[model samples]
Target: MTAADAASLVPAAAAGRPGTEFRHGLVVGKFYPPHAGHHALIAAAAARCAVVTVVVAPARRESIPLELRLDWLREAHGVTPWVRFVGVYDDHPVDYDDPAVWDLHCAVFRAALGGARVDAVFSSEAYGDELARRFDAVAVCVDPERRTVPVSGTAVRADPAGHWTHLHAAVRAWFVRRVVVVGAESTGTTTMAAALAARLGTVWVPEYGRELTARKLARLRLDRPDATVFDVTWDRDDFVEVVREQQAAEDRAARSSGPLLVCDTDARATAVWEERYLGSASAEVRAAARRPALYLLTDHVGVPFDDDGLRDGRHLRAWMTVRFRAELAGSGVPVVELTGPHERRLAEAVAACEDLLAVGWGLADPLLPVEG
Candidate 1:
């Protein structure tokens, strides 16, 4: 079945009639990286209970943050007045047969619930009955065999790309590999970013700085009709604004991107532009720089400078390229310099991205129950 079909089966809280079978239902899980199956389980609980409290209890060592998991759940489910999400650190070891360990975990859950009474314990695990017994609640197991939505936190952690369809937009944003193309003027940064995105079947974020520059020059020419690109002025605030808008654009695109996201430039590259114009980079702009998965630097060696009405950096291209290399050296992110022609550059970029994807996301495993 299609993803939409699967989503349609998971009843929204508004569509569910107020069930008299339970008052306050409790759904607990590590939710290390919540997937479609987890949402299905929660929807089942929300449909039957007057109020459902989802306790996001993940161990400390898990790669995905507890708070981020809670945010994704809340975002995915939308405004459900009766459904509440809470998170707590459950660092206790997992042992189903050990009463002491169960008690420790229960104490953590109880603290998160604020001592609220649970009428039903909703889960998809074998220990649901025991968890309900401890809470003096009824055990409501949903899709214990994984027939409804075949996914798990462990499976998602192991291979996010394999189960991309099972993830929500917010969760996908967190896992999306950001590949930024940054370079000197007339070096085909925009061309490479767009071409790579098209080749990979993903979205590309245009350079916000270029748009802002055009706007600045347009506004400048209102009084001086003969004004040129050199007439445009630069300030510390302009670079910061570029960083803000660029980062925001990247974020919006990432939510809907495929496994890979291509960007013409990022905040870090904005810092370089700031230094080029202002002679120094400000702390505000520098602090906003984020590390992406990979960087594709377009070399200006053979590429002829095209004086696009917005560009005045023909002489500074070599200097800017050297500076970008210097800044990215300490970033620790993998950088691939593209030269030769458009086809060769694209081929090199595609190979670099493939290698990065092959590395995979090495998320640490969450604590699992010991089998008898």
Candidate 2:
């Protein structure tokens, strides 16, 4: 392909035109740390589509670096020819939220592969319907069960092992042999999350603030009322310092080839909590949350109110859960939940991942032709 062709980043086409190709799918995600669920979904998409276009966002400072994420995709997953990885340009003088983002950004694609003819868009998201209507194609939801699996980058970042056991394999592999676990108090969030991590052959990031803070400042009694210049800032600073340490630790864990890096707390969720407890977050805390493959959330099912360590009542948990859902919902990332029966939830997460992968990538030609 020529430079122009490569720049266009077109999807592979069949022998057709305005009629649109019957195969070829597009799956877009951050794939921060591609996990098992992502792998399953991509595999499913690959089976259904001839070509899969994977659109990735370059990593920001707070998030896992882009270079590392790309390496994982290229080295870990191998460069999938059918799968074209394109990064959306935020610096471009275009509004990402605008409806024209696709028209403007996908132009290069259209320029190169207009003749390719796209017939369908695959996804498990409600927006899939809109994409189909907008693209004037069949928007397919590949989840055989049509059920939504609850997982989020935030949740997993909090406690990978606790709640991320069921994350897509593609995601787990990308990050490392680690599972992130996020949940409220008294959930034995640490204990259970660790157990799951051991089973998955993944490293684990214990709760940084709880452990690190406890080690350093937790003893100083930095109560909300004391509000001493020394105590308050010291504790927050300790927490921040712990975050940096954890960030380095998580990055180091991601660098190796073992089990997934089950993070104890993602920078994003941690930032959220910092604001909740500390009144407001420093610029530094807010910037640390951009990394993580996916967030896995623990549901209200088994979680109960607890005050063990820096935790509030179930009300706070519920609020945080809602916040997690809302923040991640629009982030174009995937979230999986570990609620319901263990086996059923796991199966559902896997299936959702398969559907997501299929939707995100045109990894392979459909085993069968599209029905007219």
Candidate 3:
């Protein structure tokens, strides 16, 4: 790896010309959960080469899916058109000194590239020289000392909360702790969700079912001119739409939330609402339900039901609370029932969220070299 072989860093906007030193560049990594450091290396490669090919090779035993890693890399580098990303499963044991192990790993990389010529190999590892020699290419090492980004896959896997700022929005969504507040109508669900989000300095997802109910009532009044909330009718399709929109909103919010995300309601709660109006929960609604990290069920025991105009379940609040408790119990997810004044309920909700965060993301260790 001579000085001439190492390409100087350049801006991403000024890269991707055919007359550069290398025509084709290659980068390979596990990218278990791509952090800022990984992005910087890929950007550096894209800066000097006309076309860069990134190979994401993770072991089959790894926790994160190969397709998801590819998706994250592609999305992060979508601005650079010259960069291409591919993925392949590599379960070979890690051994830098053995030639047979090298051959096994390079074979997987070549298969992913489909015989494309690699004139330059960009990496931050000590094995860059050997990898470049195998491909008969120059080694362009960037940030070999981890001084720029100051983060690694191992550090992130062990403690995501400590390195939260180094992770991309998409990757953060994978580790975000979701706490959903669910209960009967007007049972302080919205208020508690907003309060929790504010307390944690994060974002909260509003219930889509409430929005849809208001929309339905407004549409009915346009025809009858005096229609009330009771005039609004709900069908199987309405509940399905509610579940779809609710999950979409939750996913969008998760990307921008802090380590913890607060939700007014979730798809599982939509199933309960479906049963309330439609006589039974549909298979579509049930199938769309996903388990969150924790559920804070606001009991209707002490909370007063406030109907602003879109709610018609004042008398059914007690029944809805019972149904919600039963549903959450059957799902096998952790749930905490909140029963008391607003202050007490919020305190209990916060404590439950803290406990959920304490239990870190239990990601399995990646394949590594053994000490002699």
Candidate 4:
């Protein structure tokens, strides 16, 4: 490609356009987690040269896996003929302060390419210049100030949900895991969920059934003016619709939720509710209970039950607690039964959530303890 053709590939850099006259180019990074910025840098390189090779070199002990990161690049640019993705899985020095870091990475890069002619190096970091010089190619910097995409992996990791707009869909799936809190009424499910989300600095999915029921009651009151509440009298259709809507709300929230989704109630709990009041539950509602999630079963505290005119008295509340245990029995789902005062329950719930993220989601140190 000529210099002018290569220049067109540079995406409005503040330093004007760097020379991209070359037959082949290479873009290199640890790409700890490929963000939109990484995609732009690689695309810029591909547009400037006849062919471009992108390398993902991950060091030891990263929170995310090397293969997963490599897959992100491939999924993003695998269709293009000019764009090639390669991965370097080694324990090489990641810090530039290490004297041999450059040479070590250079050897790995050349080995991965198998002596292919590289006429240019594309990157958004200052080290791009040295990497290019090592390969006898010119360095074309694309967004040193992060003006194009304007995000770093560190920021994304710190608050994935806050930066949801910048993450690739594939990466979002890895970060999204659900932690549903389910129990009988007045067991502090909603209270614990709110506290956990606040402590973790993430979003929470509220119980849609409560809102739906409130609306239904309002509609009923318009006709039967004497009707003040509706509980065990709810029909099978009511329970089924609640279960479906609960799942829908959860699905929508998970798309934008951060590394962890704190759910006040889930489809499984909805089924338990269905079986409790309706005398019979639908197969579809039971099927929805099969989703894999970290379940936190809240035990009833000795606190007074605040009957919101919707609860079926204290007797049924106690019965429903037993029903929850029976329904979850032999289900093979991971369970953490929480019992104690609200403050102690919140602490236990937070630890359970952190453990769930670390073990189930493969996140190393997923949640940092919140300070007062």
Candidate 5:
């Protein structure tokens, strides 16, 4: 086959058996990276199965590392809400370069699902056929039309240049639900976020960053721009006052239900804006900026300026990206940058936020380290 043909080959979800009544089904995959094809296969498998249990390869010794591959499977399946990530481990290290252990990989799968009344097995791999035989259940291969769909992770990593975008989306939602929309003069970050929260049935956090920035501006006597005062002691009094009301709202939202939280600007963004406009940074102000899931950096789009002093044109997007990354790096929180026209950028942000949320929430509480 030509290189293009080779590269075009993508893992397709195997067609699952049709259902009239509920059957106990288990879907297993290395899920190197969950993609749309896997999604199709999963939906089919779950429909026939009353309770769908997703079995993922826990050992990432092959490629893509261990943790990330597991996360991909979790997020990909988490998007469904009904699906879940259960462990299937190969705890004993095997020489990946040796072919002897490839067939012995089912011990973890066996242990994880031991004693369960599994009616059938679902997978897109030929090895899945062997797994079905071993488990004494019908092997439901995902290749539809009785066509041989040849695709595997080896093919993907074969070329270091291969794109994994298709694979990443397949199971991204399980980890965190990301909403990275912008707050402009009018498109309503608040209103759009509220609407999205209502639609997705999640909680909404307004751009608390805006209120924080406004509060910081009020505290700084910009006329003395040359002053050397640069710690939270001098700059944080205004921030404390601003956050008093803001914290109450966050406290309420934190206590409320919903897997996703719609945050208005975070305290981190507020700190960056203060430092930029005032030419200084303090320890206390820096602490608050690290709190938001991400920053939207509202541009002069959507709604026109109605005399709000917060409007900063020209360098808004570029500067926000820099300032946000700089502030967030200390906390090791990754930020996704969303940019475009008024409504488009806002929507992009929301989508990104939902993706992160999918990844974040997918982890079992015990596995997830609590964030301060």
Candidate 6:
């Protein structure tokens, strides 16, 4: 925890500056979940150094994987030509109190840089002093009291929703759990989805297909002044577009949303709509039925269907409800049927989501779908 002379750790003279010049700098951390605080330290280092190498070190038992941490770092600084990001691992203690730990980290740090001379080490912790001493470099501490960023990875991980603003979009995506609300018309799925999201203090994704349909209907009405609700038609291409846009919107929301993302209707719901409108669904639509999601299936209790040019009457609604139940029954994903009044329905949906989250919820490391 001992720091080098603060006077000796003055700003480096680079290009146009006139203090000390750091040809190469180093910033190393577990970056378990990179927060704004980490970014501030890197910025401080990058300001005085010609080049800064960030080494991401994750312990074997860490919940967040090493590769994900590397991804976040790369995403945060990929465009910065002078900032190089790397990952290192060793069987050494993670504690900085032990001299062996410092030695092990120094070796790993040197290896990550391929023996490049590090003139400075930047960090917010006192350990930066020892780390810099190992490299014969100056220790530059940025926001040692956490006043500037006022957040940490540990705090973010402990309560993602509470400190969600501190997390990067890429890191936020790692914790977002997708909750899809599906049902026949007039079942209050949309209301429940939005309310649930509000209750959970997260984001809610509106039904993409509904918006697309409304737009198409408006255009149709303009084309033919006599266009009626029955005039609306959706071909395979239209449904395909809906599916694509729905998934895309969900993916985008996942990147920046809090711990939970409530969906009014997901890709799977779009697929069901396709099957309801068309004679059969496409392979892509069918595939969506198999994707992992926490589904809230709304029960049809003959709630009066308010026609918005999309309603197909009670018979069709009842038929679609049966189809939705049947599809959900064999989909192998977790499903909870939501019945009763609006408050009761939302309560059940919230309870179901909490239950799902308790059991590890969606796929582990959902942000890294390709790697998984």
Mark the regions of model 6 whose C-alpha exceeds 4 Å error after superposition.
Answer: 1-21, 60-67, 77-81, 89-102, 145-147, 288-293, 330-332, 354-372
TM-score of model 5 vs. true structure: 0.44
| Candidate 3: residue pairs that collide | none
**Clashing pairs in model 4?**
none
**Candidate 4 or 3, higher TM-score:** 3
Clashes of 5: 42
Worst 10 residues of 1 by lDDT: 1-10
Using TM-score as the measure, the top candidate is: 3
Task: Give all candidates' CA lDDT scores.
Answer: 0.88, 0.53, 0.87, 0.74, 0.51, 0.75
Clash total of candidate 6: 2
49-124 per-residue lDDT for model 1 (tens digits):
7777888888889888887998899888875656778787889999999999999999988777776778899999
TM-score of 3: 0.92
- Best model number under lDDT: 1
* Candidate 3 lDDT over residue span 1-372, tens digit each: 111122221224125375666777889999988999999999998888887888888998889999898888888999987777777789999999899999999998877777767889999999988999999999999998999999999999998988989999999898899899999988999999999999878999998988998898889988888999998999999988888888888899888898899998887898898889888899988998888889999999877778798889999999999999999999878999998899999899988988887888899889997555
Q: TM-score each candidate.
A: 0.91, 0.42, 0.92, 0.61, 0.44, 0.82
Off by over 4 Å in 4: 1-33, 43-170, 231-233, 290-293, 358-360, 363-372
For 213-277, candidate 2 gives per-residue lDDT tens digits of 44444445545544322342334675577678877767666654243455666666666667666
Backbone clash count, each prediction separately: 0, 75, 0, 0, 42, 2
Model 2 alpha-carbon drift over 4 Å, by segment? 1-179, 216-218, 221-236, 256-259, 306-315, 341-372
